[model samples]
Target: MKLTVVGGGSTYTPELVDGFARLRDTLPVEELVLMDPAQDRLDLVGGLARRILARQDHPGRITTTTDLDQAVDGADAVLLQLRVGGQAAREQDETWPLECGCVGQETTGAGGLAKALRTVPVVLDIADRVRRTNPHAWIIDFTNPVGIVTRALLRAGHKAVGLCNVAIGLQRKFAGLLGVEPPEVHLDHVGLNHLTWETGVRLGGPEGEDVLPGLLTRHGDRIAADLRLPRALLDRLGVVPSYYLRYYYAHDEVVRELGTKPSRAAEVAAMERELLTLYADPSLDGKPALLAERGGAYYSEAAVDLAAALLGGGGTPYQVVNTYNRGTLPFLPDDAVIEVQAAVGAKGASPLPVPSVDPLYAGLMANVTAYEDLALEAALHGGRTRVFRALLSHPLIGQYEYAEALTDRLIAHNREHLAWA
Candidate 1:
């Protein structure tokens, strides 16, 4: 099978390449294309990708290009990981929101709205190009604001699925704590992308015995520590919320913490520089250890599994993915995209039935879904009013004054990217 990576020049590409090399039997890629507009970075990342494949003695051929159509033409699948405005824009996304005394994050609050607006249009254009070239090809989006972007692709009638590393990362962590293989631990993961909870941890499969209570009884503190949440909160909620939830559960505290520390974008920019320098070394054949600190833990494994299943190859039958809800949760609209465990195959992902959600979580999910609706509107049809409404609707920035301020800041910082600005 042929695969294309649109943002193959990203520092994250090496981790993906490493997975493709190790999991060749699962995906069996015949050709792997890395497409990026940044020619210099693409060359560095592409060279490392080739070396990684060759070092593993994989039979797949790796190619690099700057042309989007050339990279995607006739591919079996296309993975979107592009950043519309790069790290500099991300720095602004992470910075300006805090000025409103709100959480500064890339996938939630005002910052996430900015990312959604900047990303959706670009992703839609790319999806349109892919459809024109290879109508049968599947689009796997790994980009930030995945829910919004995936919604855009699906709404535009593209064959697409969204992938995130959060579920896989948590699975690996839980497995280590339970002394079992990652595949042996099945999470009852539900909710929207980046805003999800592990309601249960089954031992063998989706129908296997739920061991969540036992896990909490034994490793609650450790898991809570990893999530940067209080152990008492986990015990009370009786579910493990994704780390991103910290922005909600402790909004003021998180904003204070964010104000004190350097933006994550700044740190990542520095790491990318070092990573690029390392990639230039001809002797470096494996993904550098520093890449792990760069984040997207276990991204490759998740991508491989999702791609394999979508292409009718060998992959885990049930995995966590973002797709149309289709009434998996009674509280959410059927068209709302949610992250949950599903039986994935060539047909697409179908979210498994989830137990009744506690109002606490369900209420938040509903609220965010509404905000996402407005966010997509602004993304599709840009205007200051749409932007302000999205910010006003977000639970994190519900106040009129804060929403107005954030809307202005978002537009000012992203005027170049927003055509209507």
Candidate 2:
């Protein structure tokens, strides 16, 4: 099988490629086509892939290219992990809104709309390329504005699935907090990207959601009693906690009441990094860090593992995927894409349907859902109206006049950055 990895410049490429390498025996990835706008970094990642393949005793083709058409041709799957602009662009997303009273944030609020505006065309262009070159290719999207892009792809009739590891990993954390084995826990979630809520948390099949709230109600205080919630936790968050639960705690009442955002998930990642540093040092007491993992391939390991599992017919693995709502999200717009649990298999991904979400959770999401809709419209129209509407309707950015003023400022400040006025 061949995999086309877009956005090879990601720091995570090391694990991503290594993940594929580990699955070599099962998938035997014959080709790895690494595409990136930055050719130098693409070359760097390609070199790492070569070293990984060399040591793995598996011979395969590794191609690095900036030519979009060449990179996507005939690939079984394409992993989309691109950014519209890097950290500088991200800083603008936060700081421009900070000029208003609106909280400076990423992935949600006016900043995310601005980002979606910039990124949608890029993602659409890539999707078009995949359509022309690899009609059968499955786009497993890791790009931000995931719901927007996924909807665009589906509306345009392309095969795509929006994926983030947060749900897979977040549910596991909740299970741990509830003092249950990880495998015993199951989650049902819906809503816009980085702005979702758990409608149901349970054990076993359809029966667990009923007991989850009560279990959490009784056990949650015990979990929170020892773990102090700090404000600076965003500094070290591992994978953005399913969606934007961090921001939810800060703004959304349902999330605050659920007591999840205060879980200090970032502290866990940060503390783990600290321990890793200690373990990796020569004078450290813990186990030695494996030298083979110093390369880039390890970064792609989970991605490749998941890919291989799907292709190899591993058990029905549930994934948090962004897909066309189609009925999975009962309250949200029908055409819009929402991220939720999906059962993945050889056939493909099926979005898991949960009983309707909570009124408070649904109410909180309605505002953000409008943000996603307006962002999509803005991307399509390239005008101020859609952006303004999205901004005016956001929950966190409730100050409409202030939001409008911020919009005008951002447009003026980012004239060079925006493709159009």
Candidate 3:
């Protein structure tokens, strides 16, 4: 199977490439294609990936190209991972809204809307090209504002999937806290992206042995003992939350007892700065150790080794993201295609649905839903007014007047960023 990575020039390509190389023995992959607008970086990563594959004695040929047609032709799956303006712009996405009194988590609200405005057109163009090239290929999107971009792709009637690991990652983390094996735990969740709440949780043992009552009885008292979350949530809501722990839990009664919200931007900014510093720190050595440390962190391995699964009657129990509601998920709009779980095979994919989210999460997500939806409107019309409306509608924007002012300033600030219609 020919597997193509559309944004092969990403700085994280090395880690992702290592992931693919690690899967050499487990998955049946034949060719690895690196496609990007930046041929120079692709050539560099492509050369290195080929070397790594050969050194491992695996047999997938590596090819790098700037031509979308040349790179994606006859491919089984396409991994879409790109940044329109990199982390600098990402910082702007996050910080600008925080300055405006909005919750700025880098992936929601005005930040997300800004990103969607810039990225949607480029991604849809890729999707359209995929239609003409690999008509039957599965597009696995690993980009941010994934919900927005995937929504747009589905609206345009393309085969695309959004993939975010937060849900599964949360499940596993909670299982660890519960001292149970991962697959043995059952949870009910809903909402979009990082905004979600778990409604029910059951620890599986023998069928009749309900672990929930006993387990919570013994250690449930420790739940959020020092954290902002209420320990009674274990008794009340019935499930542990999976995402937005930092923020949602921050609102627990005890924390809210402080009166006003404390800004954690410095803390969050420090983390981002540290990572950027490390990525840019050329003088730092131990490349091998660093590679090993980050190798498995982002699940790049799962991405790297997908070629064989697509062609050889072998199916990896991994998720292939697509943008289509078509009834696969009951919680989201039917026309939407979220990056939910799915099995990839020669025939294509089938998305699996989980339970709907709680009312709290649904309300939280309602804030961003309009922002996400409006970005699609902006993309389709090249409408600056729509973009303004999206930004104005964010939960953190304080007032519509402020939203309009911010939009006006942003338009003046990012004048060259958009090609106004």
Tell me the TM-score of each prediction against the true structure: 0.99, 0.78, 0.76
Model 1 lDDT-worst window of ten: 98-107
Q: Best candidate per TM-score, number?
A: 1
Rank order by lDDT, top first? 1, 2, 3
**Runs in model 1 with CA error above 4 Å?**
none
The TM-score of predicted model 3 comes to 0.76
Candidate 2's TM-score reads 0.78
For model 3, residues 1-421, the per-residue Cα lDDT tens digits are 6788888866556566666666656555687788889765665566666666766677778888998998889988888888777666666665555555554444665666677777888898898998898788877777777888778776777766566655455446557777877656554444565555544455552222345555556656654552236677657756555435545445234234322553343444454344434444443322234453321244464454234444544535444344455565454467654444455555545655555655665565655565666667886776667867877766656378767766765565455667783
Give candidate 3 regions above 4 Å deviation: 171-189, 198-237, 245-296, 301-312, 316-323, 327-332, 338-357
Candidate 2 off by > 4 Å: 25-27, 55-61, 174-184, 203-243, 252-302, 305-315
In model 3, pairs of residues that clash are 19-301, 20-304, 28-308, 160-322, 160-323, 161-321, 161-322, 162-339, 190-357, 324-337
Candidate 3, residue 14: Cα displacement in angstroms equals 2.7
Model 1 — TM-score against the truth? 0.99
- The local lDDT score (0 to 100) that residue 384 gets in candidate 1 is 96
